[model samples]
Structures are given as C-alpha cells and as structure tokens.
Target chain A: MPHISLPDHLPGITGLLEFSQNTAAPIRELTQILLRGDNSLTQGERELIATVVSHNNECRFCTSAHTAAADLLLGESETCEMVKYDLDNAPVSDKMKALLTIAKMVQKSGKSVSPEAITNAKAQGATDIEIHDTVLIAALFCLYNRYVDGLASVTPDDSSFYQYLGERIVNHGYTRLPQGYDHLKNS
Target chain B: MAYIKLPDNAAGMRGLMAFRPHLAPHLGAFTEGILCIEDGLTKAEREIIGTLVSKLNDCQLCEGVHGAVAACYLDDNEVLIEQIKEDYKKAPISDKLKALLNIATSVQKGGKYVSESQIQRARDLGATDIEIHDTVIIAATFCFFNRYLDGLGIDPIQDSEIFRQRGRMIAKGLGYAPKK
Candidate 1:
C-alpha cells in the first residue's frame, strides 16, 4: 500500500524516520511546535484543524487520531463534528470561527485569505499571535497531508487507535507514545 | 492592502523568533524516540515533508524557507525541486519517499481526510506505525507552521540563500541550547 517499507506499517515520512537518527531532533521539534507549543489557538483547536484537513486529505490514520483527540478537548459527537465539519458555523466563539475561517483560507490559498479575514479575526479579538498561529496551522496541515499521501503509509486497522492514542497524546502530549508502544509490532 | 500593518512585519517575525527561540524544545526531544527504524529515514526527510507540504500550500515564504532547507540534504537540482513542487509523483524520488509524500499530503489537508484504505495501501506497501506516526505529526505541524507564516503576513524573502544557510545551522541543532 505504501510506496515503501515502514516500521509499523504506517506510511509516509514516519517509515523513513525509523532507521536514521540525524534528522529526528529537528523533526521532533517541528512536531512539538505544531501540536503542543503554546500559541494563540488551543491544542484542541489546532488538532481540530488537523482533523478537518486529514478528513479532506482522506488520511484515516491521522483523521481518527485527531478526531479522537478533538473529542477529548471539545467533546464527543456534536462538538467533534463541529470541529470536523463547521468551525465557522460551529458553536465556538466568534473569535474562534474567525480564526478557523482564516485557517481554512490558509489551506485553500494563502492569497485567498483576504484582508477581511484577518480584520474579522482581529475584530473578534484574535491577537496577532492567534492569527499568525491559525495560518501556520492551516499551512502546516497542507504539507502534512502531502507527506502522508505522497508516501502512501499504512494506517492502523482499528478506528479506536486514534481514540486510544488521543487520550494518551492529550494527556502526555505528542512525540511520546504510550508505554510498550513497541508492542505495536505484535499488532 | 496588507492585513497587518506593513511597518510591523519585519520587526514582528524577528521579535517573535527572538522571544520564542525554543520553537520546539520539548517536541524535539520527545519525538526522538521513534528515530529508530529499518528504512533509514532521516530528519532531512521530515523537513522535506514539511517543505513539500508548504510548497503545496503555496506559501512563498515557507516554500522558500523550507525548500532551501530541504535542498541542504538533497542534491542541488533546482529542476528536481521544482518538479517535486509541481508534482511529487512525477518527480524524481525513490519509491519509499514517494509513499511518504502521499501520507504527508493527507496530513496537510487534515487527519480525517485520510481514508482507511489509504492506510491499508501504505501498509500493504510495508509502511510501519512509527513512520505513520511521525508522518501524522509532521503533516499536522507543518499545517501549524504554514499558517504561522501566512497568518502573520510574513513575506517570502527574495534571497532564498539566507533560509538555506539557516537550514544548515538548524541541521546541526540550535547550538546555544535555545536562548528562550
């Protein structure tokens, strides 16, 4: 399925990361900043964008993982769908929707995100940092989607994988998998 | 015409970077665990993933910055990089990396956008979980960074060589133990 061999059958850059050490630190740093670093957007909001983009990209492993994580931060079902389907129309605060709108534009085209988008986001009380982080989040997801789809990595067979992983990731944070994660080799 | 005031930008990106020198201090150390693998992927590969993702997103700033960064490990073939930006599948890359780019694409769009069959396809091709995990994070994070550049209205530098030089320094670590 993947274009190449992988460590746990997941595709894309993850497989490549396994056998090498020189590149890990930078990659890890980048990932941490993307998911965990403090920014204008909350972790849930950030992960929610990932879920939306993952869904758009049809990257299941990522979708399930982030969706489950979104559930933890937002809630199950309704809020999750809100994050997945309609951030602009979701029940989130106006500032959030404005930020999400700007984020979507970042996904669509950096140029398409008009001045109004930034203005509206700012009027809704989005800070320069918030606006900046929103665009960053969206732009980063585009790169991520390409990476996974480009490599054609394998996703976990279980839908619950993300849910379980989300809990662990949310509690412990990204980069650190649950204990005995290496046992996934047995899966 | 600009979303943010013009005078503020040059100072903003610099000021922000100056303040948050630890862009990913914790994440860098935490994610190193999966650095182990059989296929021999390196940090450069992940950076390429981010760079390619940024390119696809069309953020001239990020594309220029990360593109230059990605070029550090790769041979200095501008056409090849251009080909990758235009279309990775048609570009010159190993079968292994091509698959990773697919996964990264999924991550860029959003995790839910990735389908079950896609995962199966990658696995069928022999993708591993660590690779998958790292790809997800990379994709997810690039989205963050892509937005950061675009949202802040950071203009792409005309001289890409500067970003490339920065990438070289990054390849060797922050050096000063993160001033932040």
Candidate 2:
C-alpha cells in the first residue's frame, strides 16, 4: 500500500514514473543518456556505478533493478555482487575501484567525498568526464532511491520481475512504456 | 576551487551544467518540470521543500539559490522562508505544509527514514497524492543537486544579492532549462 494510489502492474520506480508523467519524461531521458548513451565508460560500468550507489543507500528495489541490469550487461552476476559487497577487492581495473570509492563517498554525503579521492581517480586513468559521469550517476540514483522508497511504492516480491526489467533496460533502454499502460495509472 | 576544471564564470551548479552541455538540458528540464510547473504544490512551496533539503544537506549554494527563489514567490511572507528553514514545524504555515516538510526532512536523512505515520498525517491534513508525491520528489532531487555541486567542490557565490536578482528572474518565469 503506497502512500499514493499508484498502479499495481508497474512496480518500484516504474510505477512512480507512470504516476507522474511530466516529471518522468525528463527523468527517463536523463537516465537513458547517462546509462545507455555513448560514452568513454561502458554501459555495464555505468550500471555498476548505479548499483553501488543504490546498494549504499540500502534501496532494495533500486539495488535489485540495477544489480540485475549490471549483471546482464557485464555478462556475470558475480561482479555486481562483488562491487556491491566488496568493491575494494572487486576484479575491476584500478580506475573502476577508485571511481567506485568516490561513488560510495557521494552516497554517504557530498562533503564526505575528499579531494584525495579525485586525485586518486585521476591517477588511475579516470578522465574528467568519467569522474563527472560517475558522480552524476550516483547522485541520480539517490534521487531515484528516495523517490521510490519515500512513497512506499510497491516492490515486487518476485525476482523474475527484476530479470525481465534487466533485459528491458539492457535492450530497450530507459523510455516510456508502450501505450495502454495509461490504463494502469492510478489504478 | 572545484576539483574539476568547471567554467570560471559560472558558479556552483551552473558551472557544472556548463561543463557538460550535452547533459545540461535534460537536468534543467527535469528541474523545471518539478519546481517551475504549477502542480498541487505551489512553486513557492516546492522551492521551500528544495531549500529545506539543501540546507539540511549543508550545500550552501543550493540552499541560498532556492531559498531566494522561494522568498521571491513568498513576497511579504518572504521572512517565512527563513522560518521554515530554521524550523518548519514551528513556522506559521498550513498543517498540510508542515506535514509535507516533515516528510522532506526524513527523506533528507535517507529514503527509508520516511515513516508511514508521516504520510498518514499529511493525508489527514488534506494533502493530495500529487502534493505528497511532489514533496518527496523535490526533497529527493535536491539531494542529487546538493551532492553534484558539493561533491565536485564548486564555489558558492558570496553575494546574496546575486541570488535575489536571479531568483526574481526565475520567479518571473526564467525557468531552470537553458535557452535553446
């Protein structure tokens, strides 16, 4: 039972997005550009950043959704779990470890991110754009995490739903759901 | 003294947005949609929510910028913006706004900190679903903005008058989106 009457069919952020289409439009666009758009960072790497931040925030729905997406894009579930639980020892490159450290700091508090972290990331070959995108992705997921959980939106108990969502995210990217989903609004 | 080489002319979030032009429009549009659009929450109330979150997050730039915008809309009630920032619960405002601000505070701490009793209280005070939804979104979005600006160590504008002038322009419909 969400605080607001959201649709039953769409769970988590999807339902909240549908309920508020105006805000949802730009939000979807932002997510698509940050996650799926061409960049120096691979889509998998970006999803990893999102997963790590969501995990730090303890947002169950977001952590599950992005973890699944990351697993698919990276072609393994092990790495996502590794990044979530033990990022320091995760089998990623040194650059990714440094970047994830910054992401974790951002998740804690903006002030928590020290100048040393930025220096370390740069030394590990993380470019300015990569650093910029990493922080933006982390910050964006914070917004998503709070939005999804603040409303007490429904989180599907079924793991299969996350698998389907992971595929859709990897294949279709973030966009508005197809038509007839309008019937689900406020339902 | 930003960690990155953000544009020198623009300060705070503006500098960061200018640093990444391709992503700026979407971020701007989203800000416009949530804060500028007249929904169940008035633009003043929405800005108030954003200001409160920024203040709590200790992002002086966002707190000052949005607080000025909120004050611009509040006009004679401009002082009330500070009151809300200091303590919304004790401030003279509708019970509905008080309830919504409480929710915003919890969200500033963390998403899971928002309680069921808070939502129920807002509902009892006649807050619509959209109002509650907008309140949470505004609070959440500020968390993003605050971190983005602060995480990179963007410098805040020292002059309060600058924020007031910008706030008036925004209040007069110069929305968050950069002009095409």
- Among all candidates shown, the one with the greatest TM-score: 2
lDDT of 2 by residue, B74-171 (tens): 88366898899888989999999999999999999888899999999999999999999999999999999999988887877899988888888888
Name model 1 segments beyond 4 Å from true: A9-26, A29-41, A178-180, B1-16, B24-59, B62-147, B158-180
Docking class of 1: acceptable
The digit string of per-residue lDDT tens for model 1 on B1-180 reads 335544444432443454344653533343333222224456656667777877766667667655665666566555666778788889877766777788778666555456666666657776676576566666656565556556566666777677766656654554212334
Q: What is the lDDT of every predicted structure here?
A: 0.63, 0.90
Looking at candidate 1 chain B, the ten consecutive residues that score lowest on lDDT are: B30-39
Model 1's alpha-carbon lDDT is: 0.63
**Alpha-carbon RMSD, candidate 2:** 1.8
Chain A fold similarity by TM-score, each prediction: 0.84, 0.95
The DockQ leader among the candidates is 2
Q: How well is each residue in A24-129 modelled by candidate 1, as lDDT tens digits? A: 4465456667678767577888887777766765666667777888889876557668766766568778887887777667666566688888888889998876
